[model samples]
Target: MGASKIGSYPCEEIVVDIVVQKSEKIFGELDVPPSKLYTQFATALALLAEGKSTLKQPLRTKDTLAILRAVENMGATVKRTQEQLSIWGVGRSLRPTGNVIDVKNSATGIAMMTAIAALSPRVSVITGDAQLRARPMPHLLKVLNNMGLKAYSTKPDDSPPLVVLGGDVRGGRISVRGMNPSLIPALLIPCPYAKKKVEFLSCGDSLQLNLALDVMKAANVKVSVGKKLSIPNQPYRPFNLRVPSDLSAAAPFVVAAVLTDSKLKLNGTDLASDRGAVLLNILKKIDVKVEVSNKFVLVRGPQQPRGTKLDLSLTPELLPIVAVLAAMAKGRTTISGASEARTMKSDRISAIAHGLRKMGVKISERKDGLIVEGQAKIKGGEVDGCNDHAVVAALVTAGLFADDKTIVRNRAEALQTSYSRFISAFQELGAHVGYAE
Candidate 1:
């Protein structure tokens, strides 16, 4: 016997039983909203800063709300209204509200805030929901522990429900696997206040590190990149910036525009920021005709998506919908360099492959990547969301050209994880997307 096929996937894809209705075309004009990651980062950075900062037109979704709550517990002043978010940074003066900071189901929230909590002189327990607990706590714990934060978990598996006995973070040189893109920045969030310079060596050598480093650079953290990042003692400077639209959220619509005979306008996004920039670059590389302006990204897709090898190493969030787009594109599409996606909120790699396989697309799975053979027609069948948001969105995008009815199970609610306006946006674009009540 080789290996048990039981629980060895990059993630656990629990099949849900749902259906998709076909649409003749896609068209819409909507502001593709600001980055939740940026919004959440503003909260964290604000809490770590010396003054107040405002996040304009930020996404106040479940995930960002989770981060807000965690920081609020850590004494970050957050006042929310319909238009903007205000964070009053108490800097290193923050004290833990309780012994535990519950990040709900957000891994990014918990992981990013965990490092901040470790800077406190009091012991703080950072934990989250079942999905969050199941995800890895990232390999950064060893460095944090060595840095005088004393981070640990009962399972000792580097996953969550972690307890960090606080002390002065004597920041020193540490090495990390860059595959978990969030981990590097998470560790760095509080390092500026640490007693010493925090140097980082990328053990995994993932190229995604640049994105995280850009985020840090935006926050005014001095990160010198080489074989190791030499970060000196720095101050958290106040930043007044606009958060750009999310590229991860922009993917399905981009796919919708390309696969259907409709034009879609993504407002408030110019393809200049991280998630949005990365996705648009990939789309451009594949010869998708998208016009990027200062205020909005004008995209009209009805052209057959051409096949190309996409490396999703830095942007693992694109794995699901990218796979869906690849399935419908012309020729063969190869996606590589995203092995870490195996352990996202779900194992996205296996989930995308499994879902596509249901709708009659030929897919070959590797430990880290996937190969999709583009077909002229999308066959009608059922697929599972694997209870993952990315999987759900991927399956939904694939359903636009699906013959007759296509069902996606265990994913309707996961839409709130990222975009609450997903179905409505598609519906506005003339797609037959709705709830199955």
Candidate 2:
């Protein structure tokens, strides 16, 4: 699989279909790295344009590699030296050979591939693993549809095996509701290349807004945000970005520290990072002591304080980890303003409720959020990951204080999407853990 050919790249598929057996010992101190969510996507897209791009401190995850591989498949040249990645894009257009693009379990790869395919004149079919196919794509689809591009699932219920007819996009006003802001970058990247101006109407608050703005600015697109956006008909520059360590990935460890009454510190995590401050506020309400410096967050826990209601619409990624914390707090906690959260993952709140219930924890669902009753003690038992990364992380966090050993099946299945070394990180923190191959 040389990097120059369009259709000769070798594809390796990996599958894990069992529970992750829990380690008896709890985790100890550990130092985590920076956020990498936006960096990887930005790099892959940069490789689509005909220019040289420099990406710094990029995320080195499987999804990042998947995106890079797709870019390589489309005839781009990417070289990595030390900590920097240099990509020479294939130019302004991709000649799609009507190839079948398989993205495996990478959601970032799927989203970026969808956008990149929009630039091609050929009909492209994009497919992934079963779980990746099951994730929602309506928000991305709606925006693409508004641009006069036809994108639909190859299977029923809008699951992937997505068929994209790439051509000139007739861009116009589009309204997106109940969608995560973190996903907006995937939509916005391709709009500038469209012939017409694209107007984006959103519900005003999304944590990914700052990241989207950053990407737009990097690409030299002038974006003005008020209630609505009026995109201009201007040529934008190609972009290169350095993605930080994913705060979303760091959240579960934050919750784990809180639950186990330990003093934990996360380095290379920025308070100015999207949703970090909001998560800190929520943890504060639950009496988790936190101190933020320029480069890290020092969290001291074991507060045993009362729980408070939260509106998690802006930070849906925090839901799974927060759910576990809320279940262990002293009083009932309510999380609202997150009806859109369900759109991200249909089984999210329900899955948490089910896992907690099985562990003898009390929780209920509301119209817009969840209501959780804290338990004095959580009795560990067998749990299912539901093929969601956050769910798997939450189960592991819960295992920290369980009365008995907690086992999480299919936890490793989600590592392909995010946090590939999650289990290894647990081991680094002194947790007793192992994986069965």
Candidate 3:
């Protein structure tokens, strides 16, 4: 399995398949809670295994549930007691009895489920929705194939419908580096059961490297990294993980506050996140007022934000939110070095441009990035989410200041990836928002 060039189309409909839970009172303008998607899924899987597992502040997102569903299908039971989820591991010898295990639209689910499938003697086929299937899985497949696991795509282009023939894993070192680095950790999840050592050579993607470290540390897989790394043979250990809040999810709110004429404070976030800090720097460059405290970050909307050029390749996840901020800025903003940003399953730059253009914002697509020329005022119009959660959030954020009502079709779709409680949060912040059944 190797990385291949694939073309993707702009999606038309963004369907949000969430039954909004009962609305609860806002706990006094607190910074939103941490919502780590990967950690939540991993925690659920750990809880389903044969052990006492503790997950702290788990993020309840679609991808996380998809992973938990996979674990449940594999004969593991999970229980939530008090504030923590208790997972009873079914051990490594457990096999999934099902024939078709659908992972839905979750990338983490596809990756982890496929990895879990490799551990069992049962032949399992992992599939997902069209969007998830469009996402690349060759990186994980390549790693598994390297470890002597018989894994193949049911289709010619190496898309989903992955048929994994489970067997004994002969672990070996594999080199992973690429534009989409998230696949690195996905490849490592199944390596603990390997009889040999597994080494990962990070190609300088910080997020991917960090995720790999987190995964290795959580599974208690002895991993050593420097220019190179080694994983020692070890028994798979279940971990009690506390999922961190998603800074990516909070970016829109942060940008919205920056664009408005109010001082907004977001609590329960890590300013230390690479993406968070990068956004802060971008704000500073654009002359947005910001103050950071020990526990929270406060952003004051500039009378008008000054736009500038940025290469957001390292922090591509923030592109959509940042683009929204640019849409409200005082100059031309250019985002480059983000051609690879499309790999995240959301063509955020293009999506924002598409939705905003309908709202009378001047947006143009560059070969590798986007250009947004801010206007003094923007009129609201109907926008579509296009099946991208980040795009939905961006549209909602943009709509907040629009002169008229900006109806976002399928706006609720954002819950699938992150920010499940966005509508309520917006309402709590005094925005007049409602959903139409």
- Kindly state the number of residue pairs that clash in model 2: 13
Q: Tally clashing residue pairs in candidate 1.
A: 11
Writing each residue's lDDT as its tens digit, candidate 1 over 1-437 gives: 11111110111222234457888777657667567677777678888887777767777567778888887888878887667677877778877789988887777787788789877878999888787787765466776776667888857567888988877788787767443666665777887888888887764443244555655676688678778888768878766666666656767877887878777776675456656677877887676878887667777657777899998876877888888888878899999988978888788999888878878889989877999998646776767777677888889889888877887776556666666666666666677877665
User: What is candidate 2's lDDT per residue for 124-177, written digit by digit as tens?
Assistant: 888877668887676677777776777887766776878888786677887876
* Top candidate by TM-score: 1
Off by over 4 Å in 2: 1-33, 178-180, 235-240
Model 1 scores a TM of 0.90
Q: Give the Å shift of residue 180 in candidate 2.
A: 4.6
Superior by lDDT: candidate 2 or candidate 3? 2
Give the per-residue lDDT digits (tens) of candidate 3, residues 122-213: 89899998887876567667767877788899877778989988786787666666525655556666666677777766546566557556
Q: How far is candidate 3 from the true structure (C-alpha RMSD, Å)?
A: 7.8
The number of the candidate with the highest lDDT is 1
Task: Tell me the whole-model lDDT of each prediction, alpha carbons only.
Answer: 0.74, 0.67, 0.66
Per TM-score, what order, best first?
1, 2, 3
Q: Candidates 1 and 2: which is better by TM-score?
A: 1
